[model samples]
Target chain A: MNIFARIGYAVMTVLAQLGRLALFTGKALAAIVSPPIYFRLILTQMMRIGYFSLPVVGLTAFFMGGVLALQIYLGGNRFGAEAIVPQVVVLGITRELGPVIAGLMIAGRVAAAIAAEIGTMKVTEQIDALTTLATNPIKYLVAPRIVAAVISMPILTLIGDSIGVLGGYIVSVYSLDFNGSAYLKNTADFLHSDDVTSGLIKAAVFGFIVALMGCYNGFHSKGGAQGVGNATTYAVVSSSILILAADYVLTALLFHK
Target chain B: MSTPKIQLIGVKKRFGSKVVLDGVDLTIEPSSSLVIIGGSGTGKSVTIKSILGIIRPDEGTILVDGEDITHINGAARDRVMRKFGMLFQGAALFDSLPVWENVAFGLIQGRGMNRAKARDIAIQKLAKVGLTEDVAFLSPSELSGGMQKRVGLARAIAADPEIIFFDEPTTGLDPIMADIINDLIVSTVKDVGATALSITHDMTSARKISDKIAMLYGGKIIWQGPTAAIDSSGNPYVDQFIHGKAEGPIKMAVKA
Candidate 1:
């Protein structure tokens, strides 16, 4: 094919994929609000997406906060601003790092799992089985994951934020020889409510993106085992990219001032 | 006479450039076993999916009980689906649920039956398929292929559906097991008085279970007759397929 033809084909392919994703998102959201809600399934997914995810998110956030404090201390030492560690760490953790880190972790864990599971079901004709059994695949499979992720991310982010701040406090007081009481006072005084709420809002949007990408890729998977593997990989890649992109957009809108 | 139980008129489906079903028309009578015989990739599964509203035909009208169900959605679609029970090629039981739950899935999820009641009916259906009560609590993955097929058969008959579709019911079973399944299919279908539509390349299973046979070739039903008359179909493709011949009017797509 000529260069122009190749370019046109690429554009069309991207547009087609975008269109499919949009349609899938619309259907999943509709299923979420419609009747015949499966509370049991939703609760089951919460345990998987939220509760099971706590340890990983907590560990990452703690280490991230400790590293951020150390880096700030090193940078601030040159400018005679070492005391700025607590304030900067709290600001960064509550506003950005906590939610984004937790989001990425869950995307890696939950999104890949959902994609592989559903994609296998598709290849094995279990999804078709569900249809023949009078169960809507979107309502039975996709909606629960999406709803669970949406409800879970914000809560996970809140816990991650607290753990991260505590990590910074530990590093600041014990390692950096700072006064523990004064560091706590500084972190509390420096952090604002908007910082925490904005991060949570970002978490919710990231959660939606993760579940949507997972379901979309899995539902459209074809062939067999190889196809399911590809779906799982794509779910993680697309959701991670989307999470980062959404973070920037949400950050601009939420903290523009 | 009674709207033929199920009807497909000019059903056509295409995936990309390849046409799977091209203007195929069929009528399945009530309380009769009709088996569609064809080679792999012959649109046999697509035909059943089209009738079940899983894959909508690009152009066609599908009627169930004389009512057009080609484009029904939501609750109406669910109601239409409640009339069908399908046994997939690989049994397709949900690995997440145990054997009994797989059988009772439709009753509890589709019809809102209490779990205890659904479980009772599930066990009864399993018993009808020659499965004992001990197999009910086991996961589908724990069962052998023949046992899984039995569980699939039990699930199909669990709801006492008006129409049952078997997609290659005996594809991977041994001859003895396959014959046993064929007998169970014929007897249980008769017991429930349900219209049975099965698709298979297995000539023995087809000949054993079906009262009538339809041969599909080149995306169309080329010949259909009573099972006894299949030998005298006089169509080269039907003869080639039924007799398992390599050299015939219907050429296999083999790469040299």
Candidate 2:
């Protein structure tokens, strides 16, 4: 009976949290559509979440792409299909690795930052100050971040895809003794517009998850500095897990046909 | 007689099983200052927060200018909020913005005033609080505690609001600084011709800044009167509190 009661409590807690997130998301969407949209704040967040993230995303994509080519070459050697390296690299990057890697990286960087800053503001009563100043914290703080993340993630993922294929080209031509132009031709030929667009779509959803989780945890944070620390950790962990889970669901939906 | 500038009737707020404000009733006339004094964890802050619409009361109506604003929100709430300015306990200035920008936030964001005009008004308000124009460009983190409080005061009065609230405006300052802040509070409230509500445990500040004083204990205002009459109120709780006596009816919740 005790175990059953505990399990029931845990389930109830999870459902309560989900319900809260749904409400928060709904409010955020409403704020996004309403007047008094903060274009300046949105632009600043774009620079922080997207532009500053380019180096890390580009580097991660490059290395992952190089490793993918090597692994596919080794696996193909075993099956006597080494010529399929370019096709697999481009497909893997555009369809899966690029969006997922960029999402996780941003989940670590932007989500943690948003949570810590907002959590501090919450503890310090700056949010209440915002209210006293006649500004909606959701419109002024949360909406800009959500809009920025949704807009920037796809652009970042697109750039990341190109860099990743370039990485595969580098490894194949320089190290694996394949002609560069042929590797490029195979990557371009096998990579359809559908694959790239699908990754971009996944990237946008992941971005929304990152910002929303960050703002939600931060807003609910209490108990001062330790609580802010907890909020930051929760934001990163939850967004990372959600990104991976969402990637799988998106992939299934996009490729099932 | 005339509609009280602010009124709270039978206000109640509870957190889970712990009831903070069982039923708080209070009134403040126009262009007056009322200071609510209570021990920490009492409902003084809750009462003010309820009036500010920061915390919605579970069972009561709050009226400002004879309008029931207890449950109003969105544009209507924003409209009511425009009449208020609050000086928080910790000065709660935005760290991301400069001092002038913090002061001008309500003007620029809430009223849609342009930067140049807002900047001019912000500097003037800062000067009113004894802050120099050069101090306007510095970040809030650069200011000392008293300066921050002054800046917070400047921000609160920047838009010449009709009502102002001070939440422990003198907490965490030196004695001299606290006295200075109390003086500033009195002068600024006068300057704006605004109804003022303040919550603090500091008796000295309460007496110095308020025309009337209220004592809150156990989630209710136990005794209230003009500042001169608080000393003779005769309510043991009020007497014990103002005199800072531990050996009275009010028991300290100290754990062994």
- Per-residue alpha-carbon lDDT of candidate 2 for residues A28-74, written as tens digits (9 for 90 to 100): 99999999999999999999999999999999999999999999999
- Candidates' lDDT values, in order? 0.94, 0.94
Cα lDDT for residue B72, candidate 1:
91
Over the stretch B38-131, how does candidate 1's per-residue lDDT look in tens digits? 9888899999999988898999899999999999998899999999999999999999999999999999999899999999999999999999
Please write out the lDDT profile of model 1 over residues A113-195, one tens digit for every residue.
99999999999999999999999999999999999999999999999999999898888888999999999999989888998
Over the stretch B152-234, how does candidate 2's per-residue lDDT look in tens digits? Answer: 99999998999999999899999999999999999999988999999999999999999999988888888999999999998
Docking class of 1: high
Which residues of candidate 2, in runs, are more than 4 Å off? A1-4, B254-256
Error at A66, model 2, angstroms: 0.9
Q: State residue A179's C-alpha deviation in candidate 2, in Å.
A: 0.6
Best of the candidates, DockQ? 1
